[model samples]
Target: MPVRAVVVFLNLLLLFFLGPSMAWASNGPAEPPRPALTVSVQQVDFVEMERILSATGNIRPWQDASVSVQTTGLRLKAVFADVGDVVQAGQLLAEFDDTIIRTEIDQTRAAIIQAQASLEQATQNAKRIRRLMGSGAVSQQEADQILAAEKINQAQLASAQAALLGQEQRLAYTRLLAPYDGVVSAKSAILGAVYSPGQELFHLIVQNKLQWEASVSSRHLSELETGTKAILHVGEGVVEGTVRQQSPALNEQTRQAIVYVDLVPSPLVKAGMFVRGDFKLGTREVIVLPRQALVLRDGFYYVFVLEENNRVALRKIDIGQSLPDGVEVLSGLVAGDTIVVKGARFLEDGDTVRVAQVAADTVPGMASVTASGAAFARAGQ
Candidate 1:
């Protein structure tokens, strides 16, 4: 009977300890597993966008003419041509005194005349001797001597004539004349001032035509073609031109190619002024996205777009030409697809997103619904 009481007491103690644990385990109905998290997302819609290739360059002369002196150490007699002067071809700009040259020519001409008179006398004697020989009145050796003397006199006359011709040609070089019809943009020659050979006296630019010369990177050179249109923005006005010349080689210093665009005749544009321009290579439909929507990670571009069933899908995009305002998605995107422009880069793929309502004017209804659904999924999760 004592054993029985002990066993009953042990059983009571065990029940006391186990009873609370069982009650605690049963407390609060088993909670169902929390739903997967949802992230709000939005889609990108396609729209018409202008695709352009842009560069900057400087305004320059259509043609530059440098009036250079041909001879050295000659004093300029008159320098009537100045900057802004209209000049025609063959118009005299300056002249050196031709007194010395004229004197030399006259002396040479007198020498030539004297040689000619002597030659005439030698020829007459040779003819008289030859006629006497033919009549058997003169010896053959005497006739030959007279003919030789006449030849020598003729050579002297020819030498004198050549000297006179040389002096006259040198005199002609004393006057500097306009090589082309152009406006003088610069002048350095002064009256009575000496100019060296190849010294520039005046700089001229073709008055009617203008060119926008821009240096472009070699990477952009392949797209260049004759007749390509370029738009130059100088200050507030726009200068439109067409590509008339493209260099086949790159510049040695900058490794850039020089491109020339012919502008419409306008007085407002001036040479040597820097300007920005856009060259249109060609046009193709591109997927345009707001710049804010893109995220750069690990040297790659990414975007998050909302999918049906409230799932946010992360996408890697290949970016193309990006302007100041937006970026162009060259690959991994298509038309009619929705991309989240706002708060897209902040979220991850497969994460539920809450999309705020955008105004109808701001975004299309279809895109907003897709965004809202993703957000609702995230909230429920």
Candidate 2:
């Protein structure tokens, strides 16, 4: 072989072997920079939280009474009050036919007048006979008989007066009056309808006073007492109430006890309205976190906790009662734990995060993010 040809073949062989090594040396593995998320963080702590017992109930009148008629076999002449009408005590609610009652009263009065005249005549006659007997013009037995007739006439007069008074009472009964200050809830008596005694003419809610009848579990009865405060949710409004009474026995089917809470008057509340109420039993120690820190995923609750080196880890938590400011943390957390309050929804487990704001310690179990900590978050926005 020629020397030049031999040299070219050796060079080609060397190039083929060095090409793979050179490429590997120039392009080696490189680490990519981790994506950092700017977020706000809060420090959570244990708090003295209220232990509230929840229950459902209905709004009812505090003093419901059925206004009824006292007289029987009287036709309803007029109805003065209708349903939803506010009436005062002794206010006429309905009227029965007073024609017969008045007529009887008039007849009794006439009878009384006649009996009075008869009594006066008998008294005069008895006096005259007694005087004559003293002079022997009348016998003693004859005078006694005259006096007896006088006594009978006087008795008849008293009987007539009693009958007239009774008839007057019956006449008053023809007008059904409100027993108390109340709002008429129902009316069953109709005009010209003959009603018997004790028949309910109208149903009244005394003074329009309403109450919440809450059904509490029998197990929680021990925690309740008269004068305990309660909060009722009625028609998008909140009503304050006090524990007025409680049932002595539990409902056989529901295993619940009825608790009556007298409510303050509110336009939003009405009788027979189904409502929900919360009874504040007492306070208890519990871990609390801001509501924004909680994340709901697949029906589970989670929060992003700030780990060492500014890294975040997704943590599951068990939540208890919800409060006006925060929620109760049942488990899976401890005091002094840092959690992402804002911008946690866009983060995942092990994600690197830059804490924009660290909340200040203001309220128990909750800390507000510092103004400086939020600088980065604001800038990002």
Model 2 per-residue lDDT tens digits across residues 1-381: 999999999999999999999999889987754757888776666667778988999898999988888888888988899999999999998888889888888888899999999999999998898678769887888889899999999999999999988888988998888999999999898899997788898999999999899999888898999998999987667999999989989999999999999999888898989999999887987777778889999999999988766789999999988888778888988876778887888988999877653433333333344543332221101
Error of 1 at 254 (Å): 7.9
Model 2: clashing residue pairs? 356-373, 357-373, 359-368, 359-369, 360-368
* Stretches of candidate 2 exceeding 4 Å from the true structure: 1-44, 128-144, 252-255, 281-284, 289-381
Error (Å) of candidate 2 at residue 185 is: 0.7
Per residue, candidate 1 scores C-alpha lDDT tens digits across 1-381 of: 699999999999999999998998899589743324432233444545656777778787888888788765567777768787888988887787777778889899899989999999999998888778777787788889899999999999999999987888778878878888888888888888877788888888866367887888998777888899888887788878899988778889999988989998666688778888888776765566667778788999988766665456788999988866578888887755566666666666776555555444454322444332432211101
- In terms of lDDT, the best-performing candidate is 2
Model 2: residue 171 alpha-carbon error in angstroms: 1.1
TM-score computed on alpha carbons, candidate 1: 0.73
Note each model's CA RMSD in angstroms. Answer: 6.5, 8.1
| Alpha-carbon deviation at 323 in model 2, angstroms | 5.0
Task: Give the runs in model 1 whose Cα sits over 4 Å from its true position.
Answer: 1-43, 56-64, 84-86, 134-145, 206-222, 249-260, 266-275, 309-311, 362-381
Position 235, candidate 1: lDDT: 74
